[model samples]
Target: MRKRIGLLLGCLIIISIFTSISVSAMTAEEIIKKRDSNEYIKTAKAESEMTIVSGNRRITKTMVSYIEGDNGLTIFTNPRDRGTKFLKRDDDLWMFFPEAEDLVKISGHMLNQGMMGSDFSYQDMMESDKLTELYKFELIGEEKIEGRNCYVLEGIAIEGKKVSYYRRKSWVDKERFVGLKEELYAQSGRLLKAMKVNKVEEIEGRWYPMESVMEDKLRKGSRTEFVIKSIEFNPKIPAGTFTLENLK
Candidate 1:
């Protein structure tokens, strides 16, 4: 009986050591990779609403967006902004004015401006690259956001990469691996924008943010609430949807 008890204790000790090793071996890159796997989609069609809030004033806009690889097209469908479109192909962005019947290319400093008077910039909407491609991430520590445990990570832009925010801090849910909050910063370490997730839903076996808010740090009492009404992942997209010709 004594020998049997000793052998059982030895087995339990070994199991505990192995479990601790596995947990401690998780790297920052692996964490980001898991997050990308859960959030990134090759193609998707989404209907969304954006509400811009400034002080006591609020304006809401409805839009339909198609995303495939690195290209995207968004069209406003609401009565007020009907027919307005934005197209992103490769590194270029173009906007269409339905009333003026004009197509304008967005570049330089204009890319940093708000998208349709919202807190989200044209550059923010155009972000299609994976976090791994644009930044080098380091595991900073762990924190709790909204009562959920999260893995804190800081990402600095990779050299020569053209990214709107030079640095970013993200709080990723430890269980679902979805980002709960993120802070965008300029090269000078000034906070540019902050995003917080209000709701998350399971869609097609993946966790997705259904509602979120983006706040412009430079603007006082201004924020944008973004809600995804519907989304279909890996949806069939018609050809020429991202072309400039389609923008007009």
Candidate 2:
């Protein structure tokens, strides 16, 4: 009886050690929070170019954007798309067309439609920083991407939560917390889109993706390359920049 009890105690100790190690490992939720915190700033200004490719055709548009918290305002600068404006306030998104002199509110099924014929949707523009609140995360494993070690994380939308992607898997750089690759899926388990970060640059002591490619799986031979021309973190954005009136 004494020998049996000692064996049981030894097994329990081994289990405890493994359990403690598991608990000490970084969690998926924590990693997501870190990435979000590192990416988002109180206020920022940026200039970017979006190049859309469809089969043999390619089009590029340039735009400038201002962001404050979850609210953002973007205006096209290229001659082809000049004066076009988009505003994202909380959960609402609106667009203004200079030529049509029309202001449109984007919601429901329209949110799923591509933005300016690009792979990005209007809903993708309204993504908030509070990822942990809307999704449950699981740390699947680690992998190497572009010569950098990354943590592989899978996220599922929480019940009753409305999100652009029902499921997502991301490869985030271990040290910089920047996402190197991401796969977005629909609720029915269909792959919708994939995003790859091609380059990263350090700006204002923070790591930011300088260029990224987004591919639409549902559309044959459709892809978009987004490049950040310049960005300023924590810049002082003028008041009313995110308001609907300013969208015009």
Candidate 3:
């Protein structure tokens, strides 16, 4: 009987090891795809507030955004930035300033510039979440972030890809597949910025980050916080909303 019990225990141990290996074999690309698919709906609208903190000063701006597939449009509603609009379609990004009555294309070096003096750049705004197409991903390991289990992934931009961050490290929640933290790096392997998700809320059966903070590593004592005031999933958006003519 003792021999039979020992044999059973040995079999259980082997099964456990195989299970562990099977779980670890799941690729980093799968994690990114899961997170991206659940992040944004087919069509959505959001009212958000961006607060920029530099040392002791705080500047806040309110905006509304509409998104469909890879296209997005943002309109500032704050008194200071009222009438300023940003539009992104496919690979092109455009900004319109009512004060100047000019529509400027954001490209090349301008893509790296801060968006509206915030830590997030124009390229960041236009970033595509389809990691498989843009980057080669490697599963680093597992970690715990803010009391939640996470899978750490390192993504390197594929050759000939024009992505903003040449390298990125993301800590994705294991259960929800939400990114809890992320670090962005330049082509020189220099850390450029870091982002942390502070709060999350469920909207229409999907989890969404309600508040997140971004810090520009190049700037001392500077950080930006984005808060989603309200969001609607799969809302009906009028046609031509992403057109330059509609920007006027």
Candidate 4:
């Protein structure tokens, strides 16, 4: 009987180990929760240097942007550019163009257009929610990406969704749910662009993507790079931080 008891315990140990491995192989969405209820959401702030190139020429624009959670975003460029330059909330759409001096509401149909003629759309440039909220994630498998063992997850937008990426392929670190690189595909099944998050900085003991480069797979020789020079978290933002009246 004692020998049988030992054999039973051994079997249980092996089962536990197998269970652990199975959970480890789960998709990134299984690991992280949406930031909406999370108390510790990181905010991004800093000077932005954007370099745009269509062909042989390049245009550089310097701006400042602030992101509060998944909704509050303020992008300021060109001191003389009018409008609040602040987008505080996002429901079904978003608005504002600093240079245009007027606010234009985005239509659900226009969400597919290239933002500023670059690879990323206006929606792509904005803050994003956790994977589980916006995507139905699945671990397709693993592969070596840039010498890193990454879990390749495929995300499909939920049916009847208003605004979303049709299909996305993300390579996430086994240890970190945040993706190191991502590819967005259009609703028509065309590869729109490739986004590479090159550098990550540990600020205040939190990891943040410091440098992001996006290439337009559809438009040749066009790219945009986001460089974060400085970051301040949880600053005292005003209640009316982004009122339309300020645009005047």
Candidate 5:
């Protein structure tokens, strides 16, 4: 029965297509040039701290996160939890359990659900399925963040069929290639989620985000944060760090 359900979701994925936004027509060469010459590497590390604020109330926790471009996402807790980890590779995501020997892919309608029921959409944590590949680039504008000026970009899905978003906004810092802020929207053009960088620190010689926050505006008073104590980018992480060999 589970296999059948996976097959059905796969079918739905195949059938769902979105309209494409003309990213190629934009300044591809310039974007690549900027990315290549930039200090941001192919991979990066961030220590995250999440705080939940609602109704004059707030809660907080610390976490560690890593991003490997062209590879996928991995999130773990600080001070370590027994076998508690989340890994998402491509379209499939799995959670690891300390006692289990296999990683289990998460499905069901809640696949799009926010992580751990936070305000952030699952898509907010995952790379926009259409970004970098689908959207044309333009150095449309800039903003001041952390006392540094950032490039403001607008992304449109190229051949945007099968997308969860229509148009998106980003504030990318030129020095680090990290987005300081992001906003996502739906096809009907409704605001869906917002991500903000709250703190930054220099680890070793690299400057990286020390704390980050994600809030789901559509859901009242809902949000998540990733707080970090340390981050080592390009560390010798095991190749299997993202596998789902055990899920229990």
Candidate 6:
């Protein structure tokens, strides 16, 4: 009887190990796909507020944006930046300056720069691609973030793909499938940026990030907090809304 009990315990341990490996192998892709499905908006209109924090200084700005697939158009409504607009179509980005009456094509290194002096880069703001499309992910481990159980994964940029960050580490809530935190890294393995989601709410039966903070790791004491004031999902958007001519 004693020998039989020992053998049964050993068998249970082996089964547990295999179960863990199976989850690790399958969970990374499944988690990312579920997250993308929940968060990726096909068509939406949003009003948002951004507060740029540099040391003790704070600057606030507001904007309204229309988004469809990979295209978006944002127009600043704040007095200081009134009439400034940004339009993104395909992989191209364009900015219109109301003060200068000029339109600038954003390309090359400019894409890496901050958007409107905020912690978010132009590429960060304009990017609409899914994570699975950009990187190959592996489930590294699990941790708890803000009292919530999270699945931690590390992703390396796929070769032949253009990406802002060469490597990324993400903490996604296991139950909700929402991304709670992410760390972006440079090609040289240096930390470039980090984001933490502060609040989330159920919108249209999907969990949505309503407030978040993004920090530029290279810049000490500088961070930006973004809040979604309002959003309408799958609203009717007019044709040519993302056109360059509309920007002018």
lDDT of 3 by residue, 3-92 (tens): 999999999999999988987878898888888877845799999999999999999999999999989999999999999999999899
Instruction: Evaluate model 6: give its TM-score.
Output: 0.90
Candidate 4 TM-score versus the reference: 0.75
lDDT of 5 by residue, 157-212 (tens): 66735566677787777666656787877768888878788776656665565567
Candidate 2: worst-modelled 10 consecutive residues by lDDT: 19-28
In candidate 4 the C-alpha lDDT for residue 156 amounts to: 84
List residue ranges in candidate 6 displaced over 4 A.
1-25
Best by TM-score: 3
- 85: Cα error in model 3, Å: 0.9
Q: Which ten residues in a row have the lowest lDDT in candidate 6?
A: 19-28
Would you estimate the TM-scores of all the predictions?
0.90, 0.88, 0.92, 0.75, 0.68, 0.90
Q: lDDT for every model?
A: 0.92, 0.90, 0.91, 0.64, 0.62, 0.92
Candidates 5 and 6, the one with greater TM-score: 6
Write down the TM-score for model 5: 0.68
lDDT score at residue 75, model 3, on the 0-100 scale: 98
Off by over 4 Å in 5: 1-47, 56-82, 97-103, 128-130, 174-177, 202-206, 246-248
List model 4 lDDT by residue over 149-246, tens digit each: 67777888878764456888877655444467888887899988888878766667556667888888888888888777777776666555455554
Q: Candidate 4: list runs displaced more than 4 Å.
A: 1-25, 31-44, 78-88, 92-101, 108-111, 126-128
Q: How many backbone clashes does candidate 4 have?
A: 0
Ten-residue segment with the worst summed lDDT in candidate 5? 17-26
- The 10 consecutive residues of candidate 4 with the worst lDDT sum are 31-40
lDDT of 6 by residue, 1-248 (tens): 99999999999999999977876766688988887777888999999999999999999999999999999999999999999999988889999998899999999899889999999999897665588888999989999999998999999999999888999999888878889999999999999999999998889898888999999999999999999999999999999899988998
lDDT against true structure, model 1:
0.92
Instruction: Give RMSD to native, each candidate.
Output: 3.0, 5.6, 2.1, 5.4, 17.3, 2.8
